[model samples]
Target: MRAADRPADLRRDLVVSGEIHYFRLDPAEWADRLDTAVRTGVTAVATYVPWLVHELPDGTFDFGQRHPHLDLVRFLDLCAERGLSVIARPGPFVMAELKNEGLGYSVLRRNPEIRAAGWDGERRPETIVDYLHPAFLAAVDTWFDAVIPLLAAHAVDRGGPIVGIQLDNEIGMLPWVTNRPDLSDRTVAEFVEGLVATTSREAVQARYGVGATSFDVTDPATWGPALRSPVDEQVLALHRDLGRFTRDRYARYVQHLRAGVRARGVGEDVALLVNIHGCWGERATMFPLGISQLHRTWADGDTIPGTDIYIGDLDLDTLPGLWTSTAFLAATCRADQPYGVLEFEVGSGDYGEALDVTTGPEAAGLKLQLAIAQGGSLVNYYLLAGGRNPELFEPVGDGNDRIAFTGERHGFAAPIRPEGDLATWFAETVHLTEAVTDAAELLRAARPERPPVTIGFVVDHYMTEYRYPGSTREAEFVAELERFRGSGPREIMTRALVVGGYAPDATLLDGPDALADLPTDRVLALAPTPSLDDDLQRALADWVRRGGRLLLSGPVPQHDMEGRPATALIDALGLDVGPTHAATPGRTPFVAPSITPDGPAWQGAEVAVGFAQPLTTRRADAGTAPLAHLARTGEPCVLDIGLGAGRVVVAAADLPCLPQIWDALLARLGAHPRIRITSDSRGVVVVPCRTPDDVEVVHVINVSPWDTAVALERDGRPVTDEPIALARRSGTWLVRRSGETRARVAYRPPRG
Candidate 1:
């Protein structure tokens, strides 16, 4: 590919890169590290140019004049000479465990007014600055003026190696993680302006019950001791409005940086990337929160959004979360927008040096396979090689003397140790990268096969970020939302479907045309809370009337998000919503399918209800049939109602992770898995992808801890007569050529 066409061209191919911090590594070891990255079959290298490291105490910049390790230009040239492309990340807030989050200390220390303040009107404990504050943006502009020119000169368009530029590292991460929204005066002003622009000034005043002007619209004090006794609709509305404003502010900050860099010689041909942060410690229950927070930044298709995946090892428990996270990322993107992993975790999970957490050697390879299987085209292994942390230009005398807070030697658990020795996982990394390179063409051409079901992704459901510090009402509200959004639907429902051999896609309901392109042949499953938006309720009713099959779990929505009456879906199904009952200590609630001798065989099977809260509803018309009933009372917990040309199955009870139950439920909606695993083990997952030319490949992953033989079939026809022996935590891709099956080992655990 031509240098000018590198960014766009790289997207077409499976671009596997590794992050190597040149500033952290010794100048003498640059060549060796570059060669080591090349040996791993990586096509490019990514590094963060920390503004804290290069900026001098006098506000001037130093590019290797003061320290040899700070020579970014020399490192870029070396990477280019070694035939490796580059991805430059110059961050005004690169949170690589650095003080002030990679910003110069003088910047924050001298201008404390730019610091972000929380709902308490106090500065946040973290050094998170107001992203769009005038002072902070001015400093960012100065930093960009100094760094973008250097990066632009080395960019692919200038016959250099830089292929992409990451705008800011993990935008809106600190605020979310710290639960501290920027409630500074400037931010509040901007929020009021946004509210007025979107709605009217009168609307803002009426909503907040404030003075006649937008200036009187003050930030709601949701936190601290001043919180209201019973949190009312006004507080919830303000919180939601603030969340929306924050997302818009983050997007504007990115756009401002993008414009600044473009003006400073960075061409439009260079791919601009954003690192989305949400998942942490391998748990992906709240991963969609990051997408919701930063959706405005990348939803326009102008910029590419990459998820920072820190999911350690792939197991049956973690597989569903990873798959859902990856699938959701893909679903949120435009058809032409390519998404990838920005910080693909590698090595041990000992960031704090106290957890004693160790990632298995085979973890990286398995994650790579799963990511690719779920439509990831690019992979950047974070800390592919380790290095020593350089001394800060001006030390603050805060304990350890290093630029980063991680200590003297950084990335000690990486595949390449800080001392330049290969770690235990190096060989596995090499194998996985080589395998991807071998099948680059096929993988690039293939796309995930369309599944028979599409799960509804409700962005507002995850707007549970703001909370009163110790308010019981706030705690209960958050728990309730988490149950419906995180635990019940995301964790249980998603896992049950995937493990049951069903590949389901996701559709973001926040979009204006959410159901416009929804396939009528597929079942649309949603986990609704007690309340849903009025517009969405109507849209879903119309969709069902237009012949779209619907499956709903949890309670029937009787009100909108603000707790106002809105029951279009319930009314359409001819059902009366009833009270929800929780399982008590002694009298445990259970649900069982109603026995029908002539019904499907699965209807006779009993559902194992383990701690599931069941909601009771009554049929108001003859069109509704009781599929399941609460064992405690005989009230219908699961109902199948027929609409004009479609059907709606209301599963009022939160189902557990039972494959048989999910299979039976989906079967009722005329949905079946294309790929089936007829194995006793439920740990194996099958994902099928097909190229444009009709070439088919199936990815069989065994996420269990023990070896198992899996029998796979496609459309009820067996692919192979003999069972395929898969080692523990291993996966393989089988390609069908004519009448023969060829196996490409993606990752296999080393045998004893």
Candidate 2:
């Protein structure tokens, strides 16, 4: 659905909700816990309707007839009485640490043939089922028949508390997390059928090389030379095809479920959401993998896409990854679809009881503000209230005694403990929620300020999920993938730009017309690799010819995505580039900065360490000027080439994250930061959002672990004369009106 065509109630807006498992909590205390959530300033509450908890031993279901905790209707009534909306998550496969991933044990036992198998033709260790298998879909249809009707009756259109219905819980999460894509017989047959239908049978055979017909095309082996260094072109091609096929299958599965739910009385009035899962712990490097895997699921703009962010803190090391993740998500989304966070990290990080560290209250505050600053309109804190995991109706001797794997009392680190008492972080949660609630109107109408630079997002770079388990060459494969298809270069470049005081926008480069749509006034930066899409390479060349400033880092494209030699970009711009190589063991690799007479005095040598490998660029045309050269070798590793009406800066070296280097490079392209911070701390991030009426909200965040005072500027004008003092790991918004001379601070954390 288009943005203009959306129903009034389904319009994108600020929704601050918290996840509260009603089935896990005692039914008697449901009112109190929900009252606490309302007191915390959340407008709504989200809960996963675990099928495992509501299903009976027989083929029937139980809606509190046998157990009080399973009374979903009662919980909805309580929410409506309190004037609180609900986001019901009835998952056919809810991976909330539940055995069989929240599916009915009886269903799985009865349909054992539906289980997903690995490359070895054996059932995978996890209880994940083949998503498209007939038996599995049939089971899901049965489960949805029991759940969707009840949810529809409680939907907002019916004067009930239900505002949104999540189609499924993190589709393809288990397979990706386990590195075991379903290779079951039925799945493989369907994949082959899809391959033949999408591309011709002849093309499939030609790509696989060994296949004479579509049926002969088998999946690549999980071991041996397929995953080793110098991988065969046929094997690599098949892997890419398999990745595409898996993503297509996931999209089709979601489409099927969406149709099912809509057919069962759910309609456009209630928002449909899809939770995307990829990031884990403190690193968001692989987050884009989820985006690529599920891009097709929501590309039609029917359902809203929300990422499941589990990143703990916003430090220098992790901040860039989160920025990349948010930017990439925005880049891939349609203009009408606004993204959000389905599982926003809150409380503590000790889910396993092994990690004795607690996530600071400031962490959630910073993350929430960051999400808002990046155009996020919806957020649901994963666990706001802890509760007990109810026992299963029938246990099958599986070590897990309760419905979930996280022991009896789950979510011990939540703001409200299992016993109905408030945790230490409860007050801070209230403060942050109130702050957002107060600024809801301003945030809903505001859009982030457009930056002068655009970062190219290549979805294929994140399609590195086909790792062979237990292979001796696994480390080598991972290293190679990191160099070619990982987020290493993207991370370094984003870190440099943000630290250099420039917030850049991202655009997906995989689309056919993406490069044509990019603004020529802004500089376009991309982390190019040898195996870039051939079409994209040609488009980049054309983009440069059309007066678009280009910044190409990492390796210059030498081969197409199919592993065939193709150099449209290199050939378009007169350049001679070679393969990238790591620095010699004990020797430091450095690039001497360019010192042109007429240009800005770009001082300091940029060094490459650890995983920052330097690519070799031998020569360029006479029109090219050397921007930076390899330090002792004196070979030009960074060159400024003037092509047609545009200019391109090719930095073959993946330099370390240095603000000075990025500032100097951007200065060469006439790109200056719109927002700047003058502070003692280097970890400060300044983000600005504005409404059409010229009301601006500047989000000043200090990601450092130490307190600091900061002064900000926008478009080269001082925001305020008085410096804003920010405590460690805190952020605040500076609201500026068009007529107002001074800016007012909002959501500023109290100083210790």
Candidate 3:
């Protein structure tokens, strides 16, 4: 964002590194840890300097004063000495599970006002603090005053090792501050000031659909409690103002903290990154709110102070975690700059479960590589390595221990040990990092955010909480959760995208893009909740005419969120929901579907079972291609005409069609231009990083911990009827190939 004219060039130059609390490691072992990191070919090293670790509220600051452990300059000097840049995070609210680290526990216990109040007005210790509280900002400013000079003096841009400086870790501390809890008088006053600047009280009342003259503008305290519970009038009145307030809160606080960061004298161009908690992964209701935040900040304003590709936080990370979430960040980031994964599960620990999913070393490498392979220009592996906890000064949630979770205390179990010895996985990570450095350019070039294809988020699972108000656990409801059902659609479509045989730009959509008429290569069947926006429905209709291939299924949308009769676009193609009968399994292996086929119907494929008495049948206007048919089940699978430039296909049944068709269908979908590689080779992860000249650097990793070899076509050659070896363990098999080096595949040796 700083180099507005030089955005791309600036992003391309970033070399994201990993983190290990150098202080946590014994000084004796720092050398080895540093060596492992350098050997890994990492560009920068990241570490957090928690206020709790360095200062105890009374204002005394210590930088390794007495013990070598507290040594600050020595650590920065080491990074510079090692030629590794550093991402310095000095948090007054550093929430890396450090006790009293973020909002001092002592403050929470002693100053009850600092704690977030619950419904009963009792302060909750978990995440104390009013984020917008003036007192809190004042406190943060005080902390910044001391840390900034040390950092500024040693900043990488200043010929020192420090490169990027992150703003306050995660923003809001009081989600409890939502509808519950009185908006601390300080926040309410600021709220009025914000409203005054952004909206007039008269306008606010008008928007809230209330009597314009009824409310007095003198005080906002009345507004908070009155508007907390939504009235239809309030929804409209507060929608824009509410968004403005939150953004103002974010911008104000961030601006407040940044004042300290900037006042320290660090180069203005040095990036200031902040992370948005993937609040949806844990509590999905938070997504719309985050989106609103997006609408408030980056989307509209050019002058707003912030970097692009805002870092998104995720608590649950799976292979295809949430492309919607990932892509959302990409959209915001790419619009301004390149995407970045500010926080991710690199070392691997969950709410409390440590050392469970090794993800093996290959998995870790796979994510980082793919991230770069995706449009993530820079990635920060949260805990490149962990060390001793400072003490659970303010243990939130389940209380703190050595590690904060039920298991280990002291965020331990890192690639680098507390003493700094590299773990077995450490070696794999080294190899992976080396692979990335080997192919940085290509990864940047092949970023999905910049790609052409749009990854569809069918109305299925991820947003079920919002999509269908009361439908949570019912069998059919669960079946239609926006994410899960839509996942199947996304996977198949992604196949076409990857197989389309070129490095296509991939954009993810959980909300509506259909209206954008985004050139659809293919719409994967993500069975989003049978609800879609009005604009999306209209978009798909235009897209079909303009030549877009749609793969809509799972549950063909039958309504908008309010459940009005839907399927306007596909209606012409014969897509419709049948009866609401319980379409359960019958007694026979080959159950007869309710329909009789019109022609050859399918290519020797028999239908197993159809929808619960409901079938999407053709109207007189529908054109059909007999892709597949099940006689016994009487299910007629057709390829609808008007695939825009191509054709539209709908499969009312789950794929793999009786285990016999998995390979072929997968192969076909893989080759489909619209389908991208939704599967990261689950068993074997293949991440391609392109070199400077666009030469692809394929990092073939055998995530399997034990030694194993994989077969893959190399240098664009045929499969050789056998896979190319992945070699034993963390083999950093590099290959140069054509079209992404996708053909330069990856797989592990099969178990006996």
Candidate 4:
């Protein structure tokens, strides 16, 4: 085939795909199902190959010898004949509500060591197997030996329809509860070794006032919340390090799976896709479970980690968070790779109770459009065609038959229903797929442009939410090391910025490389913690020196990641953080501060909710200016200091709680919003994207219950002089102009 016409090249463009389970449906319906998929403008289809279903009790495997429904090879052949590519998810643990998460019952039952253990060295609530366990890997090796050869033969390079291989679904989700650094013997050994290697015996003695011989990694109590008390800084450091250690294990598991797939002759050209569950703004802070720290895990070039967004319903509060999350997902992945929403909300799902709202066609269409605008080049609905769960039979006896874990005919609101008929959402699905197909060229080259303002997403701060839930204030602070910066500031900044008519990018601050990834012209909203790493501290100092405006929240870093006193950035900026102060208790009102008119705009604005004993910084530079002060104490709350070509704004109070203050800071930095939405309606979002032909297209999404009057602007000029009424829970593509001239533009709804 010609290079341009090759299937591999075609995979790079914007494509619509949906999950279809051949194993769950009758073989007679396969042809009709494939036909329906094509009519929906789907270039690809995806399915999970469950190991539990394929393997029999007698140590023998069935490749559709008895039942055609179990015929994966035949299904791939049908897709190839229909000209639809495939995304095959062959999991030893596919947690699609399957019993034992699709693992062969005998596998875990025979080897208890492979099972994930909880805090007390007991089995977790779910039957999730540890990925790196040697015996479990051995079992996977056996399964891959049989299954991968069949999958490899159907890959596009080998002239078949398979174009992608999903490497395990939602890694780290199994044991995401509190005390979750699986206390398996192997895990404990690794954790202790990591701590001893990175930290010194002298450092440990200084913090704990004890010898290194007293350290114990195997004791579950040592890892509990008691160790986090402010007095026990040494244990707090160890606790935080354990979270890091667990993160490494998750990344290595991906590497192992990718290696296993490649070793079986699966070509490199086929995409390696992994998915993360729930990393949507404030919702992502529900960490250790639905969400995980994506920075350390998805580093391999062959692998592309996509976010799994299942917004049951669209509300005003959910819209911006979703928008922020999708942008965060795009930023998390490599810039060049096509952004993906591997499992978007196709319809209402059930988790014993109805997990989603009644998502009609309007809500469905708007969700897809917003995803595309946020940089989703590849979109896959979780269940394109809903179907009945298969009744399993074991050779051992009738008692061994497993009931359907997700209930019979699980998807009641899927785009395609269980009876080979279209659901209410079918029309919208068709429209979106067709639109994506028509605009593939434009969508392929378009990426989410970096906003002029951004709030840094420090992973270490967010990942530590699972610690010290019930500990006293002092203990919790000590247990988390000096780095107890939680999601409060990060969440507030994102929400406040959106409310202030600015959509800020979430630039990660995990390592030095993250600094280079940021757009230098942008303003960074950073709430520094005492536990900032030495490398990150230097990077932030360099950013301010390079003329970037740094917005500070809580306290400047007085210590490094290990709780060791280190302040390279603090010294560079010529500021010293003084003693901490806390508000008087018994009243919810934290701080009521008044902004000074002498500073930036938004002065005289009211500030509610005082910060938690934040440090007061003593400025060493004569040029340092105070912008705002606490109403009660008359102490400076907002301070600005000039550093080299740029400037830094440090707020003694939490910046997020003060929106008007953020508005002033943004205005002072001279940051202009790319697009502004003027609407009283909640959950109305505007996403601007540039097509390959340089056409400016804005995706307007109204997720509210009522119709909203929305207007768009570019460089302060309104695309339309008057506001357009967006229907309730609907979406549309608004094109600014048709031709090359950037002059006087005429508006028109995009052709679907």
Q: Which candidate should be chosen as best, given lDDT against the real structure?
A: 2
TM-score of each: 0.93, 0.93, 0.71, 0.86
**C-alpha positional error of residue 70 in candidate 2 after TM-score superposition, expressed in Å:** 0.7
Counting clashing residue pairs in each candidate, in order, gives 0, 0, 64, 10
Candidate 1, residues 1-752, lDDT tens digits: the string is 11212332455777888999998888999999888888888888999999998989899998887788889999999988877889888998888877778998778877789887776566766887888878888888889889999999988888889888998998888877887777776676666667788888778767765322222344433222222221343556666677777777888888898889889998877888888888866676678788888878887796778888887778877776677777778878888788889899977877666767778887887888888888888889898999988888787898876798888989888888898999877987888788787787788777889988778888877777776463555556566677776325447777777777777778888734578777798888787776677788878888888999988877677766655688777766766755666666776567777754446424344554544333344555576667777776777778777788888888787667766677877887898898777777778888888888877777888788888888877766777667789888877887765545543444344543
Candidate 4, clashing residue pairs? 228-475, 228-479, 229-475, 230-474, 230-475, 316-683, 581-613, 590-610, 591-609, 591-610
Select the stronger candidate by TM-score from 3 and 4: 4
**For each candidate, what is the lDDT?**
0.77, 0.78, 0.49, 0.66
CA RMSD of all predictions: 3.3, 4.0, 7.6, 4.8
Residue 679 CA displacement from its true place in model 1, Å: 1.2
* Candidates 2 and 3 compared by TM-score, better number: 2
Please report how far candidate 4 places residue 236 from its true position, in Å: 2.0
For candidate 2, write residues 107-166 as lDDT tens digits.
778899988776445467687788888888999999999999999998988878888889
Consecutive 10-residue window with the lowest summed lDDT within model 3: 1-10
Q: How close is candidate 1 to the true structure, as a TM-score?
A: 0.93
